[model samples]
Target: MALMKLATTWERFILKDLTKFGRYAKVELTPPSPGELGQVVKGAGGFVKDALTFKWAQATVKEATVNTIVIAEIACWFFIGECIGKGSLVGYQV
Candidate 1:
């Protein structure tokens, strides 16, 4: 149990760092316009709304921004679940 806890802790730390790094990298790579940033935020908001209201599972970002948005949405959900006393779980379709 102790080892499992330690591993989970380490994994979270790594994920946090990687997320920060990715955000910084994206900012440096292409500074998005206000509209683009708004779109991303809107996309994430829609995702959260759907997730909460209907248990919907949808990717927040479109194909072009998949990597960045997916990472960001996962981080957002992690923080949200931590705050709300729930665990993040997604269903798998066969």
Candidate 2:
């Protein structure tokens, strides 16, 4: 009986999480239109300007940690994609 109760709770939690994810996916999974692409370019330019001024050097520890994690995640994904493309974990199968 306890095992069944645990499974029921887990199912409920998973369903709740999936609903939340679906809400975000609807908004975030779409490709940007041309106007949005222009805005993205402008925002990136502003970010580059700040970096040139060493503005990021003054970030709070929490913000710096978050940024570092994001960069690391991107690097990890890049390597994972390369491995998948080459069909090898260590080196290309040449």
Candidate 3:
């Protein structure tokens, strides 16, 4: 019984060390392909179109204008942020 217990303890220690080593492994996220980028742009354009239509049909012009402007601004900033992130990634690769 004592020998069996010793063997089990050693096995647990080895597995713990392996788990620690696996935690330090590197991970990467590659850039999207041209086709994928095109699809994303198309989707964004569709969203802008929908927002415009909704704004035009609203009962209050003031609220509609504000919402439309906010949506457009957010979409522009999202694309700009993506470009900046890609630029930084390129620098990291070099």
Which order, best to worst by TM-score? 2, 3, 1
State candidate 2's TM-score. Answer: 0.62
lDDT of 3 by residue, 1-94 (tens): 9999988997899878877767754322457789989999999999799778885575488877887899999999997887787786344434
Estimate candidate 1's alpha-carbon lDDT, on a 0 to 1 scale: 0.79
Across 9-73, the per-residue lDDT of candidate 1 in tens digits comes to 98899888999999999879987899999999999999788778865445444643876778899
Which digits, one per residue and each the tens of the lDDT, describe model 2 over residues 1-94? 9999999998899988999999999999999999999999999999999999999999999999999999999999999999999998987898
lDDT of each: 0.79, 0.96, 0.78
Name the candidate, 1 or 2, with the larger lDDT value. Answer: 2
Q: TM-score for each prediction? A: 0.30, 0.62, 0.32
User: What is the lDDT for 42 in model 1?
Assistant: 97
* Candidate 3 backbone overlaps, count: 0
Top-TM-score structure, candidate number: 2
Name the regions of candidate 1 deviating beyond 4 angstroms. Answer: 1-28, 55-94
